[model samples]
Structures are given as structure tokens and as C-alpha cells.
Target: MNIVLTIDTNFAPQAAACIASVCENNKDVSSISFFILTTGIKEPAGKKLHTLVESYDRTLDIIDIGNIYQYFDSDFDTAGWSEIILARLLMARFLPVSVSRVLYLDGDTIVRRSLSPLWNTDLDSNLIGAVREPTASAERRKALHIADMRYFNSGVLLIDLDSWRSNSIEKTLLDYCRNHKAVLFASDQDAINGALATRIKELSPSYNYVNSFFYYPYSALVRMCRPAQYISRENYEAAIADPTIVHFLGEERPWRAGNTHQYRSDYAHYLSLTPFSNMPMEQGWETYFKAWRTFNTATKPFPMLRYRIITSLIPTFMRFRAAKRRRT
Candidate 1:
């Protein structure tokens, strides 16, 4: 299986932990190779990561994509995004023509079990296989001109590179990104779904069980994304019970020291196995307190709306507590 990840220096530890998780969990897979696309990763980080992957008897290809992404910087609305977002789309350009497929896992995801099923699923006619973004806003969908609103998250993609190369899908995505700068919300994700929402094969949520599953039930996501086809509640429950991949979406990631995510220890376990084992955890007790306190604010008046309201304030609450701690 060809697994790919694109990240910058800030995400090195995350990338390592994710790689560790995949190598540890997918032992049954015979030919697992990782392709990491980056401009430049600093010293021991690059060296140590190579060692970690080699220890598992796997090949790691680190490709430097250079400054090709700079062309998009001046035109796009890049509020919170980095250049790595643009580099992700250049996979078709960097990878060899012989490589027909790739499973692109984001730095924030962890593989908890065998990926053989997901890797082997036949993409009959779809350009790519992806999971629907549980909370794709209506406005964003409209901006992308997606009439059915079947927008997908680009985080964990099972790409059919053969189709991508032959069909000029890469050119299409690049053109869409260049032209629709005003409409792009999630940037690269918008480009993918905007051009290929109908063309994308919707993977089961179990393959990309986003963290939102913890706060909103499966029924709620079904209601929100309103996907034409969805899993039964029983299957949904089963997926939650043992997701093949756990995606840490939004701000509440497992890397934080006091994060309340169920997978914090799972992430830590993987991190401990990586070269960046000494990487210190960020945030503290205040983060844990603020998180749960805000989460409990879920109310009858637009439950998700209310949760977002409190969730937005958690940073302020944590800052106040941190200041108090420093004074003492």
C-alpha cells in the first residue's frame, strides 16, 4: 500500500506519530511504503523519522516539492492555512507514473487496525474515495456550486492516481483552485469536491471516523451532512466502538496535554514509539476543564450552535487560568 502525508515543521511530531500508528497496526499488509511530501524538514527530525520507519522494515520516501505552492499565496484567502495545504495537491506531479494509487492520510489521523480493506476497495469509476465532511456548511457547498451538497473532507483520501493522471483531474483541480479563490473555503478540499463531488466514491465513515462523532451522534451527522446513502445506526455504533482510523478534526486534537479526547493515550502511545518521543505535550489542566465545561453547554436551542458558542470561548477561559497559575 502507498500511504502519503504532506506536512511542515510544526507538524513533524504529528506526522511521525501517525506513521508509527500505521506501521504498528497494519502488520498484515505486505508492501507498505510511506511517501512524505515536504519542502524541508529540519535536522534530526528528518533523520530520526527515517530511522523509526526503517525499524519497522518499511520504506519512507521524503519528497521535497520546493516552492511551487508560492504561486497561490498572493491570490487566495489564507487566514489559517499554510503552504502545506497547496503542496498536498501536487502528489500527481511528484509521484512516479507507475504508482497508480495512494491512500493519503493527514498528520492528525491514527490507524487503529488493518487498512487492507480500505486499500483494496475497488474504485469502479470514481476519481477518488473519501468521507463526507460531517458539518459541510450550506454556504460553502453553494460557493463550490455543488447542487447536492455532497462535499468531502480531503484528509483521508483513497486516490485513483491512474484516473487522476489520465483524466487530467490534477489540471482540473489546479484550474478550479486558481479560478475559484473567492469561493474556496477549505481550499484544497473545496477544489477536490467542487470538481468531483459526483465523481467521488463515498467511503464508509468507519474508515475516517472524525472526532465530531464524540460530541454529535451518528444520527446527527446524517441529519447534518444529509448524505444520500448512510450506514445503519447499528453499524454507526459499531464503527464508533472500533473505528479503523480515528481523525482528530478541528482544534481539539489529542496532542494537547489535557485534551479530553478518548484517543489521547492512543496518540501518546504512538508518539512514544517515534523519534520525537521527547516531544513535550502542550496545554494543561485548564484545557481539560474548559473543554468539558464548554461541551456541557450543549442545549436544546440549536445544540451544535450552542456548543460552538461555548467552544469559541474556551481559549479565553484557558488563558485566564494560565495567567493565574503563572502569578502563583
Candidate 2:
């Protein structure tokens, strides 16, 4: 099966580790091919990543896409949503023309087990296959207008490359974004969610276990109940000991040498197996936390506060109107 991963230069070291871990863990599986889609980087991070893939000359291919904004709406931010766009772009341009199916993983991910299971899953002749995102509840399912309540995670996708090319998936997605710009909450993610709403084929949670951002209580409960059933510090260690893939998802990543998350040990384990040992990890968690705080204030809090104030006064105003109505 053709295995493709896309990453910008920002996560180059993690990307190297991700590719290396996959090759290392699945020793029996050497038939995989790797391709990288470089976005904002000047020189090729893909070429640098090739050295880490074990079989150097035979296992990897670097496709320098330069900047993706050429075809996308530059108004939206991709800092948080590049993977979705890169996966679609790679399927359109990087993989072999003859290739039918492709698996695209984020740069922060590490492979712990043989990808054969994920690669071999039937897409039911659909355009893509992916582990459903944990947060996509029945409410979100309805919001996406998909009746099955299954919304696939964009993090890891098993794409039908031939179908994508034949159907012009990239063009279709771009066109959708162009038409319904406001619908896109985070550009690539929201656009793809809007585009592939009902068409997605769902896989098991074990395939793409995401850390809950805002829904911590419920997501944490789910995690605690199914520690061994999915990905976490405990399961991550187990996976590393045996190793398929580990995805350091979201804004906070495990590749940073100073990353202090509970799962940092697991990341360090796989990091030991990769070429990133010499490179210094990025800035510490303080910077990450500050950025998270800043993002929340800018995007949600103030507006939410205003909504709360308005709702708080509405009950008092409604009571006054009720008393007046009785007097009338």
C-alpha cells in the first residue's frame, strides 16, 4: 500500500520521527512508500525527512508543493487546518497516477503497528476511509447533515487516489469553499466537513484517537473508561512497546523535547527510535498555553460572555412584562 504523509517545515523534525517510527515498528512491512507535501517551507523538508525513513533511496519521495494558497482561499487561516488541505492536495498531485488507495497521516503521528489493517479496510467504493473523530456526536452529526452520525476524522484518511483524481475532489472542495465561504470555520477542516459530510466512510476509534479540546469532561470520561481501548499515555506506552502509529494531535505536540504532557514519555520512546534525537525540540508549554489562551479570547470567550449577559437579563425583563400583562 502507498503511504503518504504531509507536513510543513514547521514540524519537520516530528515528521521525520513519524515516518521513521512507522518503518521501525512494522519490520515485517517494508512495502510502504512515503510522500511529503511541503507547504510554506522554502527548501524541501520532504528531502530532509527522507533520510529518516530507513531505506533512504527506496522508500521515500518528496513532492515540493511550495505554497498551497495558490489554489485555496488565502483569507482563511491554515495554521490549525493544513492537514486536511494537504491530504487532498497530495492525493491530487503527489501519489502515483496508477495508485488507487493512499493513507495520509499528520506529521506529528508515529506508526506503532503494521498499517496493513487500516490500508486494507474497504472504502465500500467510497472516496475515503477514516477513523471517526471522537467529538463528532449525534448533534454534530446532524449539524453536518449526515444521518448516520458518523463524521470521519480528517487527521488520518484512507483515500481512493484514483477516485479523487477522476472526481476532481480538490477542485470540488475549492469550489465549495469559494461558494460558501462563511460555512468554513477553519478553512480546510470546515470546508472538507462541508464537502464530504454524508459521503465519509467511518472506521474504528483506535485508528485516529484525538484529544478532546473543549469537551474535556465527557471526552476524559470516555478516555478513562476505555484506556486500553484507545490512545492515551497508557495505551501509547503499550503501542510503543509493540509499536503501529501514534499521533501527537492538536496544537500541543509530543515531539517537543520539553513537552511535559503525561504522554511525553511515550513520545520520547518513539523519538529514541527516530532521527530527531540530535535536533532540539521546539519552545516549551508556556508558550503553547499562552497561545491557547490568546486564541480562546479572540475566538470564543468575549462573544460568549456577551451572550451570557444578554440571557441573564432576559428573565428579569420577561417577569416585568408578565406583571404588566396581568395589570392590563
Candidate 3:
């Protein structure tokens, strides 16, 4: 199986943990190859990763993408996004021509199960396989001009490189980004969905169980807002029970303190096995509070107003009781 990850220096430790989880869980896969795309990762960090992968008897390939953007020739605004985000867009150009299929995982994801089933999934005529974004509504899909409600989260992608190249997927993505720069929300993700709208096969939520799944109330609120875009309750519950891949999708990460995800301990378990085991966890109370405030304030206007009024009118103890009820 061919697995790819894109990261920079700051995310090297987490990426290593993600790889460790994959190696630990999928030991039965005899021919696992890992490809890392980065822009100038420190030699020490690279060596640590190399040693970790070697210990698992897996091949690690690091591709330097320091000057990759120079070849794009587009004026797309990539300010908020890392250059590494663009690496997946050009996977067809960079990966070996003989590699027809590759699984591209974000650095923030940890594999909890053997990927053999996902790797062997028949894509039929699809160019990529991905899970749908839980927060994306049908209204959001229409705004992006996507024909169907198939807007996928690009965190976990099973790509068909041959199909991508034959269909000019890369060129199409670049063109879309270049022409509609201001409209892009999640840059590479939006570009991919826009370009391969019809060629994407929806993968099960278990393959990419996002961070929101850890907090039931928040996840339910998101689903209630966009029932059509979200996965069914059965799939969500199954993924929560046993996820194939756990994705730390939002700003809160396992390495940071104040992150209360159920799988944060799982990430730490993998991290303890890496060379960066002694790395310090940063305090994130402010970050957590900010996220909480944003969540309370940023829903659709009607929901936001109702939430604020309900919270304000209810007694503090009663509100606490209500929250505890929601969690169960």
C-alpha cells in the first residue's frame, strides 16, 4: 500500500505519531510505502522519522517541495494555507508513473485499523474516494456551484493517479483556483471538489471520523443544521465506536493541552513511541475558550439567537444539567 503525507517542520512530530499508528496497526501489510512531501524539514526531524519507519521495516520517501509552487504560474491567494497543502494537488505529477493508486492522509490523522479494505476498495470509474464534510450544507454546495451534495473533506483521500492525470484533474484544480480565488474557503479542498465533482466516490465515515465526532452535542448540532450533508446516525455511531482513521480536523489538536477529544490519549500513546516523546505539551486554554465562544456564536443566525437566549434565560445549574443530558 502506498501512503502519502504532507507536512512542515511544525507538524513533523504529529506526522510521525500518525505514521507510527499506521505502522503499528497495519503490520500485516508486507509492502507499505510512505511518501512524505515537505518544504525543507530539519535534518534531525527527518532522521527521526526515517528511523521510526525503518524500525517498522517500511520504506519512507521524502520529496522536497520547496520550489514546487514556482511551476504553478497562478496568482491564487495561498496566504492562510501552507504550501504543503498544494502537494496533494500535484501528486499525479510527482508520484511514480507506475503507481496507479495511493492513499493521501493529512498529517493530523491516525490510523486505528488495517487499511487493506480501504486500499482494495473498488473505485470503479471514480478519480478519488473521500468522506463528506459533516459541516458542509446543501446551501454551501450550491454556493460553490457543485452539481451534487457530494462535497468531500480532503483529509483522507484514496486517489487514482492514472485517472487524475488522464482527466487533467491537476490542471482543472489550478484553473479553478486561479479564476475564483476569492470564493475559495478551504483552498485545496474546494479546488478538488470543484474540479472532480462528478468523479469522487464517497467513502464511509469510519475512514475519516472527524474531531467533531468526539463531542456528541456539537456533532449533533452540526448534523441538525445540514441533515442532507451529514452521515447517517448509524454510520456516525459505528465510527465513534471503532474508527478506521481518527482525524484531528479542527484547530484543537491532541498535542495541545485543553483538547478534550476522546482520541487525544490515543494520539499521545503513539507519540510516546516516537523520538519526540519528550516534547512538551503547550497550554491551550485560551484556544479552547475561543473555539467554544465561536461555536456558541457562529451558527446560522436563527440558531445562534435561540442558543444565546436559551442559555441566558436558563438557570446555571439547569443549563449544566441540560449539557450533561446532551452528552449522554
Candidate 4:
């Protein structure tokens, strides 16, 4: 089994940590290859990336997709979200024809446990296996006028390349970009969903537990809120109970400086194992905290606030109504 990880050069630090963790944690996994896909990475950063990968004796392949804006011109600044497109293009370019099976992971994720189960899961169903998306069907994705529930998250994927190539998944994604450029969300996520919605096999949500605390309050507080307990709502807690791989999806990522998400420490634990142990963890932590505060303070909850007020008043009015009705 060829374990493959795809990282965009923009997120090189987390990508390096991700690669290091993969090397340290899953030492038993026989074949491991790390690919850093760059549109245009600086030479110094590229050198550091090469050095880190070589230190572990892992195969490092750097695949460049030229300029990202050349293909995804909808919003040039939101290029960070284009990992899916670049990854697909990179796979087509570098993945060997002999590589029948491969796994693709986001750089933001920390591999806590083994990947063998996901790598070995039955893909006879002609599907790319991934963790099920954990947010409300209507919220996480744009309102696609289709079914209420969607198939899976794209972060941690166990791909059957034979099926992928046979089905022309890459071409289909690019085709969607060509045809429906208007409604495409900032990232290639919508394109992948459109192309592989029905074609994907839903892996356990534990594998790609999206860290949206607002949507998944239970998941957000699962570990800290319930130390002796576990819930099956999202993949992280489920994986904690029976861990194969745990993915940190959404804004509250582990690598960020002061992230409040439940599994931040879990990610830190893996990071500490890396050679950069002496590096100050607080630097990254502070950046995450600032971003979190900015997001929360700037967010307006008009609808939710209105609903809360109405809900709060309902019981009082109902009590009065019931008393009046009894007297009558």
C-alpha cells in the first residue's frame, strides 16, 4: 500500500509537521511517500521542505501545477482553498500507473493512529472512501438542490486510483469549473462534491471530524466536556474510542496557535514528537487565538438571537394562558 500525502507549499510548516508525524506514528507502514504540490514556492522554503523530508528518509516529490490563478480565476486570493484541484492534477501527473491504491490527506490533519484500516477498507464498490461530513447538511455546504444529507468530507480520502482514472474524476472536476463557474464556492470542495457525491464511499466520520464547534457542540466538547464518556456524532470522538486515523477539519485546527477546539492537544502531542520540539509552540498558538477572537466577535447572530428571545418568552406567555384558561 502506497501512503500518499498532498500538501500545498503555502502551508509548508504544517505540511512538514504532518509529514514528520506520519513518519513517526505509522513506522510500520511499509511504503510512505510525501508530495508537496506548489504553484510557485520560494527556493528557501522549498529547500527546508526537502531537508525535512530527506531527514526521515521518505520519498519527497514536488509537483507544480503552474499558477493556480491560471485555472481558478474566480477568486485569486482564495487560492489556499484550491488544494483539491491541485491534488487531483498532481496525482494525474506524478502517481504511478502501478499505484492501484493511495490515501490523500490534508496538511492541517494530525495522524494520531494507524492508517492501515482506511488504506485496507474494501473499495470494491468503485468509490473513493472518506469520512462523512459532520456539519448540518444545509449548513456545511451550499444549498445544492439535491438530497438533505451529503456523502463525505474530502480531507481524508482513501482513493482507488484505478476507479478514479477509469471514471475520469479529474476531468470531471475541471469540467465543472468550466461550466458552473458562477455558483462554485471559494474552494474545489463543491466541484469534488458535484463530481464524486454519489461515487464516494462514506468512511466513518471519526476519520475526518470537522472541528466546527458551533455546529458540532457535542463534538467540540466531547473530550474535555466528557472525559469518561464518548459520543458517535462526529469522527474524532468515535476515532478516539476506536482510533484508526483522526482528521482535524474546519477552522479550529490543531496547528494554529491558540485553537480552542477539543482535540488541539491531541495534535500538539504528535507535533512534539517531531525534531522541531525546541520550537516555541506558543507562537502558533497565539495566532490561532487571535483569529478565533476575530471570527467570533465579528460574527452576528441576529436570527439566532431573535429565536432565543421568542423561545424564552414563549413559556411565560403559555403559563399565563393556561392559568386564564383554567379560570374560565
Candidate 5:
């Protein structure tokens, strides 16, 4: 299996733990290669990562791709979001052409089991395999141009490089971005969904069990995302109970001290085995003090209450709505 990832100096330690999870869990697979597209990562960080991967007798290649994202137009940038979105979308540019397929994992993901099944999935005519994103689907309807079209998170992508190159997926995405420009507020995600919605093969949610699944019940989450197609409640519960890949996104990231993420111990377990085990654990007091955070958690049992709170908090001046307005 060929695995690829992108990271910066700040994320080296977290990425190391992520890689460790992959290596440790997929030990059954005798042939696994790791390709890391990195930026601004210095000596000791690089050295430490190299040692960890090699200890498991796995191959590791760190490609230093510094500030190349600056070449992209300003349309892709949002105030707080990093340029890492640009780098991740350009993974095909950095990976070897000889590699027909590569599994792209974000630095925040942890592999929980053998990924042989996911790796062996048939892409057919599709350019990529990914799980559908649940949050903010209605807000992205205009960007995706189809109400029923699936919008996927780029956090965990199983890319078919052969199909990508043969069909010029990269060029298509770039052209779409250029055409839509600033309207593609979500940048990488919008570009992928807008350009290649029909060409994507939806993977089972088990593959990328996101942090949201930990808090919201399947029924409540379904009402929240209102996706065109979703898994059965039983499947959702099963996947949540034993997820294949644990993705820590938003503020519930396990690395922070005060985070109440359900799978935080899993992250700690992998990190303990990595070279960065000694990394400090801290979360801002402000994060803990947020009234909304406490309220959100408390209202998890009552979806209606949470929805009302969210809608009230969002400014009316913004185009983004907390939830889709119901049909009469």
C-alpha cells in the first residue's frame, strides 16, 4: 500500500503520531510505503520522524515543498485558514507518477485497523474515494451546483493516481477554481465537489469516522446534515463503536488537554509510541470557558435546542445559515 500525507513544521509531531498509528495498525501488510509532502520542517523534527518510520522497517520519504502554495491566487485563502489546503489538493503533483494509487491522510487522522480493505477498493471510473462530509452541506449547495450532489471532506482521500492523470483531474479542479474564483469559499473541498462530484466513489463512513460521530446520535446527525444518502442507523452505530480511522477535526482535537473527544486515549497511545511522546498537552482556558462549547455539549441530547442556539449565534449579515430552512 502506498500512503501519502502533507505537513508543516508545526504539525510534524502530530503527523509523526498519525504515521505511527498507520504503521502499527497495518503491520499485517508487508509492503507499505510512506510519502510525506512537507514544508518548513527543520532538522530534529525530520530526523525524529525518519527514526520512527524506520524502526517499524517501513520506508519513509519526506519531500520538502516550501511555500509553493503562494503561487495559487488569493481566492483560495480565508482569514484564519492556512494555505495547507492548497498543498493537500496538489498531492498528485508531488507523488510519483509510477504510483497508480495513494491513500492521502491528513496529519490529524489515526488509523485504527488494517487498511487493506480500503486500499483494495475499486475506483472504477472515479478519480477518488472519500467519505461524504456532513457539516455545512446546505451552505455549500450553491458551490456544488446540485442540491443532491455529495460534498466530501479532503481529510482522508483514497486517490487513484492513474485515473487522476489520465483524466486530468488536477487540471479540471484548477480550472473550476479559476472560473468560480472567490465563490469557492471552501477552496479545495468546493473545487473537488464542484468539478468531480460525479467522478467520486463514496466510501463507507467507517473509513473516516469523524469526530462529530462521537457526540451526535446517528438519527440526530442525519437530521443535522440532511445528506441525500446516508448509512442506516445500525451501520452508523457499528462504525462509531469500532471505527477504522479516527479523524480529529475542529476544536475537539485530542491533542489539546481539555478536549473531551471520545477517542483521545487512542491518540495518546500512538503518540506515546512515537518520538514526540514528550510533547506538551495544553488547551487555552478560553476554550474551556466558552459558554457555547459547554452549551453545545449539554444540548447534544436535544438537537432542536442546539439548532436554535446555532442559528441565534450566527450573524444575519453572513450568507451561511446554521441549518437549511425547511420546506413548507
Candidate 6:
């Protein structure tokens, strides 16, 4: 299986944890190759990653994507996005032609099961296989002008390099980003979906369960309010029950202290198996407070504030109601 991850020095530790989880969970596989695309990662970090993967008898390929970024043009402000986020767009350029299929994973993800099934999936004529974004809605799709309303999250992708190259997917993605700077919401994700809208095959949500899945009633409430835009209840329930991959979306990482994700300990378990096991956890209460503040500000101020108050005052009962609401 060919697994690819794009990350820089800052996210090397998290990437290591992700790699560790993949190696640990898929030990039965005969050959697993990891391709790490980065602008520049320190030697020590590289060595640590090499050692970690070598310990599991897997091959690691580190490719520099610094020079490749120069060819692409985008007016969209990349404030929170990492430089390597765009690397997946150029997979066909960086990866070898002999590599027909590749599974691209973000650094903030942990593979909980063997990815062989995903790897072996037939893309047919599709350029990529990806999970539909959990939060994708009709309004958001309409805003992006995605006529198909199939906005897939580019975080975890199963790519058919042959189809991508044949259809010029790389250039298509770059050109889309270059032309539609104003419409690009999630950066590379928006570009990929826009360019290859009809060519993307929807994968099971279990393959790329986002952090929102762990937020309990909050995610359920969003689904209830926007049933047409959200993932179906059956798929949502299946993903929550047994996710193949858990993605730590946004800045609230499990490694950071005060993270409220239900799978924080699962991340820690994988972290412990890697070379950076002793890395210090985030301390200070300020981080937690900041996350709380961000949560309150995510939606309409009044409704979010009211929800916070209800959750705080009612607690257990409200949680039960939320779960019940999810079932119905």
C-alpha cells in the first residue's frame, strides 16, 4: 500500500503519530510505503520518522515540495493553511508514474483500521475517491457554485494517478485555483472538488471521520437543522461507532491539552509508540479558554450563547436529549 502525507517541521510529531497508527494497525500487510512530502523538515525529525517507520519494517520516502509551490498561483489568503496543504494537488508531479494508486492522508489523522480495503477500492473512471465533508450543505455548495452538490473533503483521498494524469487533474486543480480565487473556501479542497466534481467517487464516511463527529450533540444538532446538507444518520452513526480513520480537524488537536475530542487518548496511545513519545503535552488553561471562546463564536452569537448556557445548566439531561434527537 502507498500512503502519502504532506507536512512541515512544525507538524512532524503529529505526522509521526499518524504514521505510527497506520503501521501499528496494518501490521499484517506485506509492504507499506509512506511518502512524506514537505518543504523542509529538520534532520533530527527526519531521522526520528525514519527510525519509527523502519522499526515497523516499512519504507519511507521524503520528497521536498518547496520548489513545486512556485509554479502555482492563487490570490486566496492562506492564513491558517500550511504550505504543504497544496502538495496533494501536485501528487502526480511528485509521485512516481509507476505508483498507480495512492492514499493521501493529512498529518492530523490517525488510521484506526487496515487501509487495504480503501487502497484496493476501484475508482473506475473517477480521478479520486474521497469522503463528502460532514458539514457540507446545500447553501455552501450553492455558494461555491458546485452544481453536483458533492463537495468532498480532500483530507483523506484515494487517488488513481492514471486517471488524474490522463485527465490533467493537477493542472486543472491549479488552474481552477488561479481562476476562481474568490470562490475558494477550503483552499485546495475547493479547487479539487470544483475541477473534478463529476470525477470524484464518494467513499464511506468511516474512512475520514472529522473531529466534528466527536462533538456529540453539537454535530447532531447541525445535521438536524440541515438534513439536506449533512451526512445521513445511518452513515453518521456507523462512522461514530467504528471509524476507519479519525481526523483532528482544525486547530483543536488531541495532543494539545484541554482538547475535548473523545479520542484524545487514542491519539496519545499512537504518540506513545513513536520516537516523540516524551514530547511535552500542551499546558496552561489559556488554550482551553481560547477554544471555549472560539466555540461560542462559531455560529450566530445569540444561539451559540444560549446553547452554551443550556449545556452548562442542564448538562446530563441535555446530552440525553441530543442523543435521542439523533436517533429520531
Off by over 4 Å in 2: 40-47, 54-58, 74-87, 136-148, 213-244, 286-328
Ranking by lDDT: 1, 3, 6, 5, 2, 4
Which ranges in model 3 have alpha carbons more than 4 Å from their true place?
Answer: 137-139, 216-231, 284-328
Residue-wise C-alpha lDDT for candidate 5, range 110-134, written one tens digit per residue: 9999999999999887889998776
Q: Which stretches of candidate 5 lie over 4 Å from their true place?
A: 225-227, 285-293, 304-328
Writing each residue's lDDT as its tens digit, candidate 2 over 222-274 gives 43333223335454434334434445664466655344444566666766655
lDDT of 3 by residue, 157-254 (tens): 99988878888888898888777667675678988888778888989888998854554344554543453455666766776688899999755678
Q: Write the per-residue lDDT of candidate 1 for residues 128-160, one digit (tens) a residue.
A: 999877667655677888846677789999999
* Tens-digit lDDT string for candidate 6 (178-267): 887765656688888777888888898789888545543445445423443555677667766889898887546787776666678889
TM-scores, all candidates, are 0.88, 0.71, 0.84, 0.71, 0.89, 0.83
Return whichever of 1 and 6 wins on lDDT.
1
- For candidate 3, which ten residues in a row score worst on lDDT? 306-315
Every candidate's lDDT: 0.80, 0.60, 0.78, 0.59, 0.77, 0.78
TM-score between candidate 6 and the true structure = 0.83
Question: What's model 2's overall lDDT?
Answer: 0.60
Regions of candidate 6 where Cα sits further than 4 Å from its true position: 74-76, 137-139, 216-232, 284-328
* Ten contiguous residues minimizing lDDT sum, candidate 2: 221-230
Candidate 1: list runs displaced more than 4 Å.
Answer: 71-73, 227-229, 284-292, 300-304, 307-328
What clash count goes with each model?
A: 0, 8, 0, 5, 0, 0
Q: Please give the distance, in angstroms, between residue 316's alpha carbon in candidate 4 and its true position after superposition.
A: 36
